[model samples]
Target: MKFVQPIRDKRKIEAMKKVLKSESVRDYALFVLGINSGLRISDLLALSVDDVTTETGNIKERITLKENKTGKTKDFPIGTSAHKALKEYLDTSSLETTSPLFLSRKGTKAIRREQAYRILNNAARTVGIKDKIGTHTLRKTFAYHAYKSGYDLSMIQKLLNHSAPSVTLRYIGITQEEMDDVYLTLNL
Candidate 1:
């Protein structure tokens, strides 16, 4: 599948939150976990309470999974934001350690890519970003924000379980324009 990059903006995130927070607490948890974990939506959708929140009350060790696409084991430490989101969702729903991390309004399975895209799009429309947003957007948001926060490209690559730094940079949307600007502006 050709991954379409989504524009990550503060407004766009807020719009998604407005929609997600307006619905079930489970949905809000799903959105927060994705943006924070940098997990593929599939991994996020597959999460169970035991994958994150635990009886000890702090998050468990890093999430470990074999990514469906790459078939490689990936592990990422849960960030503060994701931890808080999961806790809130757990508290609200009283989910057990083994229950699915997210669920439908009727408490069925959470959702798949098709339904996830629709849920996010409805939120995007309300927030007024006409740009395309997809299930991958949240995952990309995690990478974009991590890049902006100064995480090394190589480290980000490792976190995403990507094979190369170049691919990671491109996925995070750094471009020749920015590179050229940097080259031209360098005083040293």
Candidate 2:
């Protein structure tokens, strides 16, 4: 498989949101929830309306699911950005509780992995993101930003369920230049 990079620029992320929201709220919600929750595309797509919303149709404070690859139960709190986007989409959508959160236009099933890839890849290109982008970009973007925001490498590794900090660092695409800056800036 080809390696994909994170959307490193906040401006580009915002641009992607704006463009995607203009086109489809479902797509926008997908992007917002993907980056904020750091879920694999399979887990993200597998979500049902009931997974994110209460029986009364309120957004849930957190989401819990089984990871497709690791077969482990994962849970995380939903951030404000993800909540807002979900509220907007669910309010407008008429899907049932058991229906797929990101439904396909041609059927009731969740959108296929290839469709998710195209949706994100097209948005990245529209935002002038030159890096390789795919469904994995959303997960990597979350890891990258969480690291940049001063979260410890160990914490990020745990979040991504990776085996080692070095794997998390490389998976998030941290560069030699960034590592060098850490040495230069911490001069003591």
Among the numbered candidates, top TM-score falls to 2
Predict model 1's lDDT versus the native. 0.77
Q: Return the TM-score for candidate 2, rounded to 2 decimals.
A: 0.98
Task: Please report how far candidate 2 places residue 21 from its true position, in Å.
Answer: 0.2
| Cα error, candidate 2, residue 45 (Å) | 0.4
User: Which 10-residue window in model 1 sums to the lowest lDDT?
Assistant: 103-112
lDDT of 2: 0.96
lDDT of 1 by residue, 42-159 (tens): 8788877777755775577578878877888877787777777777777777666777777655565756678777777777777887766778878888898888888888878888
Model 1 pairs whose backbones collide: none
- Taking all chains together, each candidate's TM-score versus the true structure is 0.86, 0.98
Off by over 4 Å in 1: 56-61
Query: For residues 55-166, could you state the per-residue lDDT of candidate 2 as single tens digits?
Result: 8999999999999999999999999999999999999999999999999999989999999999998988998999999999999999999999999999999999999999
Question: Each candidate's lDDT (Cα)?
Answer: 0.77, 0.96
What TM-score does candidate 1 get on C-alpha atoms?
Answer: 0.86
